[model samples]
Target: MISITNLSYYLGSRALYENASLHIKPNQKIGLIGLNGTGKSTLLRIINGEYQADGGTISKAGDVTLGFLNQDLLSYQTDDSILSVAMQAFARQNELQRQIDELLHEMETNYRDELVDKLGKVQEEFDALDGYTVQARAEEILEGLGFSTDDLQRPLRTFSGGWRMRVMLAKLLLQKPSLLMLDEPTNHLDLPSIQWVEKYIQTYEGAVIVVSHDREFLDNVIDVTVEVAGAKLNYYPGNYSFYLEEKALRNEIQKGAYENQQAKIRQTERFIERFKAKATKAKQAQSRVKQLARMELVDAVIDETARVNFKFQFSTQPGRHILHLDDITKAYGPKRILTRADIRLERGDKVALIGANGRGKSTLLRIISGSEPVNEGKRQLGHNVSFSFYAQHQLESLSVEDTLLDELKHANPTKSEGELRGVLGCFLFSNDEVFKKIKVLSGGEKSRVALAKVLLSQANFLLLDEPTNHLDMQSVNILIQALEQYEGTYVVVSHDRYFVSQIANKIWYIEDEQIKEYPGTYDEYEWWMEERKEQEGNSKSVDRKPAPAPQPATTTPRASDDERKEWQRTLKKLTQQAEESETKISQLEERKKRLEAELADPATYGDSKLMQAKNDEYHRVKAEISQLQDEWENAMLEAEEWEKKLA
Candidate 1:
């Protein structure tokens, strides 16, 4: 329905696109992918006419409606109810509705022939436009995007930023334009909302162009992939996986050609060098030089940016049982989230927490991380456990006044400047980027910084909530690789099925106020769910009764009074040990900070003997700090376990 012929665009001195062209056909779903700042959004804006291309012709079919979901908020609806905002998408239908009503009112009052004829005509138009069902359709889309019935009446200003984005998305979906352009439509959506969008786009009659970091969503929705790199656009005939395979195949062929060309050039150069002065080879040498000048060199197929290289460094190894939750329940007044949820996590276990929106996946992660208290539950951290948490909103904790480098430096003041820069480099911040303040960073940049902070902490356990929310595919893959290699236990709550499948060995599915554990990967869990669904359908057909519940197991005998008293002493001793260990860790960190400061000085490097001595002391202090941290965590975990037993 739309075509771009010889399109060219520029951002100041940078050429975002040069003679790039592509055609978008009706009912085609295209995924636009590139690194950050590669003009994915810029190209969308150009297509939407928000920005004119430097030199390009974007021709559209006559009377084709367009809906572009950029960051720009819809105008003049901040105080309106969400339903009212969505209903406005059907302005033509609303007008038809009004005309029909007017004609009916006129016919009822005057009973004239002209009024009756006009009423019939208006009703026909309204019926053709589906005006009568617009309200119901709007409500359905809202509900699919995770809004409750009551939420339809609430003003848009009452919702959080993420929820408000959903409201805008609902309006766009309701509009159902001929060409829909969505830029990161899945950024703030939960699993159910994303699924709704996936299904909607798959069945949508119009064409769609989306720029998303969500690999799995794209794989399910898009039929074509447009890759923007190196000031050029490449089209893949299939989805993301196919794009990968196809790109590799093309690169291999290009590489072979490049190698052959280089070999011929080398042979020509050798002949020239060996016989340039001889009369027999003069013409050939000149011919080879001309050929070299006329040759079109092939650019090496390499990543535009460096991949992240880092891993979670653990100071201590937790016990066999990493965590245990007994009879856990959580509720907010009348709305219960989790009920009697009992779970045991073992060391080295990677669990993916999956559930619908508002179904307690994040709530469960919070409860395990001890950031939120359970209404009724007894939980214990195993001995030597030390953990870090990354919440979806964790980026909000960054200081606006600090630069990216400063914020990371504040986390570990003892880290040398060079070491800190190395970590930042792994996260893709370098040169002047390190000096950019947190307030100026984009959401994805902030998320990357938050993640880098989490990785730098020496924790044996990781509790992540929507860690991939704003990350690009490259960053997500980097994280997946790191987590896959991590030696500690982790429980991640993510809606990215591809990422979850890459990292999780087990699945913890939350539904109906209960947690169900599946002992397999995400793909396996999907198969298991499908099989169970089939079994249930067959049983329903047979009209059989449900099976009986199993009998409860017998309890172990209680401990004697002397044993309990010894446990009390042990708890007291552990508490004191924890306090002492913390003090030692603090002392070491202070000494390490001094050593790092000394190392930062140019004068210290000038004296080789003194530099070596300080460096030695720095290494010793770092190793000691790691040991002290392990001791501290071990003491704290043992104390918590003892307290649980005594209770």
Candidate 2:
């Protein structure tokens, strides 16, 4: 367990945290969330002892270990094999193993009783630590993170930066420290790798604090959320979804209190002004003035909901056929990236391109955008189909000397100053913030600014590469909403499952030098994945089964046309029942909400009649809701069976 008390940190004149206090319980999984530059990573660094806090204390239990995986720490060259680097996590255990080996050799020749005893002690320590299984564990983690069997032997230098980051993640996961601190752990992961990491974290015994922009990942993996905002920390009891609702309620309460205090202050000032010179009311006026002096004015916190809205409007509509890639073949020297790939994009199509790191997802995006040429194949862009491309390494393309506002203006030369400012404000940059130099901005800020510039380009077809990399949950959500409403076509390469779930209408999975399309929402894709796994398990079990005795084949059950029609009718009835039960559940939820609101009123707090009535209503609604849910589930199962039989 770790405890932070009265913590305060500052960078020059900017305060990151002031009197921040947080307590992390043992084995608790926490999600750290905040706006850009709110010190989520800095706080992690302070906890890891890599950076010292300006004030206050951080206390940890005896011999507590901490592991941190940040973007800056993963700047390793690719020349090192991924497995070799992952195995470094067991350095301490390896050292102990070496000591054990030396003692064994010494005892084997000398046969001294004292030497043999020391050797036994060393071997026992090694066995207790599971040192022998270190290599196997390391390999398993690396493979789960998307490194192929052949990739284990490939030098790290041959891998891309994203793949190198995956290697670093594998190393950290294998380390298994008492406390794991991960910032954007899902950034470099593909869907499958992300799923693997989620399963691993769920089963991990140690505590975890992850800072991620992916809302679904946090909701699935973390039990608590620690929100950093306005130079303070707020803790929520449940996951990100619960945190969002709780924070909204807290903000509503704060705003109400602030308004009430302001009203009181205004009333006191008016009373003093009106009665200042009146002889009969002079005492009252003076008393009002004193009261005003004694009153501690409430400082209104900025409302996050009031942030600028981003709505991209483009006058020109793209051609019905946006892009066509025919027999595209790409290679880097001897290694082929894509082989005989054919893809078509139509107007208003929102597609997500997903694959493991170094699988050429970005390469395909570039090929379609015409930024890179295919080694073999023809790519055609539809007439009047203007495209805006956002690269993962877009920072290198930006001018460091330009201010954020200037960059936007340069990108949209036709836009007026007001229009440019409005666009920047949508991305959370406003007023003086727009004047900050691009070089001075944080990575997340630069990402936002880059995205704002792209949105302002007025392109009907957008190609984005890892656009959510450095964004926080709030910014990502805003982007998702904007993209959802945009009429333009989108081809994005992202590892953020939540973002993909929100915006992507189709998923193009790239694997083994090919792309496969899954036409559905993310939930459908997940269901298909689970079904495939179950099928594979069943197949394996069948393979292990003994041979069956030969017997005469019996007639298979064949329903007549009338029987099949009756089965279909039953299936329809079951489906209707399921839907009706779900509707009842929704109605109960609405009643429960109303009952809770009434129970929260102060007038009903101590009234025995009101309390009993509200409690009864609450229990009744809950019981109905539970019963409806059960009925819905059973109805669904019956409907599924009926449908299968009909099929």
Candidate 3:
């Protein structure tokens, strides 16, 4: 519905995009991805008209509307309830409602035929928009995004940045814009909320362009991947996983082509150099130089993948047991987070703490790190154990005035500046980037710096809460590699399933205010959970009471002659209805097949009117087919019931 052609945008003098063109088609699910500094979010802003492109054109159909959900919305707050905020999406409907109310008041004060007519028109329009159910729609979306029913009436200002972001997301989803552009939406959502959004986006009628670092979420929701690289938008026909494979193959081919081109250039240059001074071959050498000048150079493939190579070390090795908690009871005001909960951690344990939001995952992390106080219980640390806790709030704790180099030094005074720079380099802060002040760093940059500090702390045990929050896919991979190589015990809370799956061997979740463990990988845990759900479903569906034995029928009275004839007539009519319904269904199915073929034709795409007509008719035909099928089934069912009665 929207076309971005020859789009060029700049940051200072550096070109973020040059001649980058991307066509967003109707109902297309697109994953916009790249490294941290790439302009994924900027592209969205350009499309939403918040930022102007330096050059080129962005065209949208008159019918297309846009809704954008970005991190900047985290600062949006009001005393109004969240439901009220989300319901604001229905501007037209709300106006119509107001008009209806005014007209009704005017009728009570001074009745007029014109007033009645206007009221009727406004009410009709409101009903046409399904205005009455807008509140329910808002609530459904808010709850789907992890808000409770009671929380809907809570003021938006009461929520944290992440929760407020969810409110904005709910508002956008409620708007149902023709093209939805989301920037790192999954960063603010929990696992359940993420999955809910995935399902919703899969069925959404509009086009979607999502910028996210969550690999699993991208794969689940998007059908296309667009990579921003080399000042160009590269399109992939499939999801993130497919993009990875395809990019690898393309890189290999590019590398080969580049090498061949370089060799050819070297050979041509050598021939020119050797023959240029000779009288007989001078003309030929000049011609060769012209040919070299005309030759198109194949650009070399640059591998930008960041790697973590630093080993995690501690001054003292802890005993087998790292941490233990017993009968822990914790509460915030009247809301009890954990009651009589107990958990244990051993050395070398890699645990992924996960669950829906407000389930005490972070609270439990704080408790384990001894940062949170418990109402009743005992927490003990093993011998020689040292720990570092990394949380989102820690990003704020960073010294904004210090350079990245200085920050790492503060984390560990013993580590030299060179050693700290090496650590920062592994986190993708290299060369002059280490000299950048912490205040100038982006969210992902700040996160990397904080993580580097955690690493420099040389702690034997780590409590990491949502460490992947601001990280891009590559940064997350770096953290994964670091954790994979570490021998320390750590419990990390994350909603990014792919990140958790790669690094965690054990799954931990809070249930009934108690910490529960699944001693397996993430995939295994998922499979087991699905199986458990199925088992529970089957148990609920199981017939609790043994079915009574079939009783034999004994009939003494025969139907009267009139009654018998009436019964026969009813059965015959039912049979005829069934046959007629079947015929209609067959005809509709045939019609549906023809429409599908026409819609699939390439020529249809060339004509917008024809394409729209076919699409509308396609849905109409499908709905008709479904209705006819249902009627046919009902007819057959009635015929069967009649037969049973006669028997």
Q: Pick the candidate with the highest TM-score.
A: 3
Give the per-residue lDDT of model 3 (tens digit) for 392-505.
888999999999988888889978788888898888888988999999999899999999899779899988999998898888888888898888999999999999999899
Q: What TM-score do all the candidates reach, one by one?
A: 0.80, 0.78, 0.82
Ranking by lDDT: 3, 1, 2
Candidate 2 structure quality by residue, lDDT tens digits, 1-647: 89999999999999999999999888899999988778998999999998889999999999688888888855788566778888889887888888987887776778888887887887788888898898889888888888888889889888777788888888888888999999888877887798899999999999999998888899999999999987888889999899889988887888889999999889888989999999999999999988888988766867665534666766354445678788889999998988998778877889988767677888888888888987898997854478899986887788999988789888878788888888777787778888889999877888888888888888999999989988876678768867877788989998887788889888887767877788887778879878999999989888576778889889878999999999998998998997787677667777887888889888887798989989998998888777776677678668868877876
Clashing residue pairs found in predicted model 3 = none
Tell me the tens digit of each residue's lDDT in model 1 across 1-647. 88998889988889999999999998899999988878899988888888898887999999788998876663434888999888989898888888877877777778988877887887888889888899999999999999999989999988877788888888898888999999988877888899999999999999999999888899999999999988778899899989988888888898888888888879878977887788988888787788888988876667533455564566555556689988899999999988998898988899999867778888888889888898898888875688889986788999988998889887667577788788787777888888899999988899888887887777889899888877888788778867877788999998898999899999998877888899999999989988999999997899677778988989878889999999999999999997787677667767887898999899999999999999999999888877876776678778879988888
lDDT of 2 at 341: 84
Worst 10-residue lDDT window, candidate 1: 303-312
Superposition error at 388 for model 1 (Å):
2.1
What is candidate 2's CA lDDT for residue 570?
91
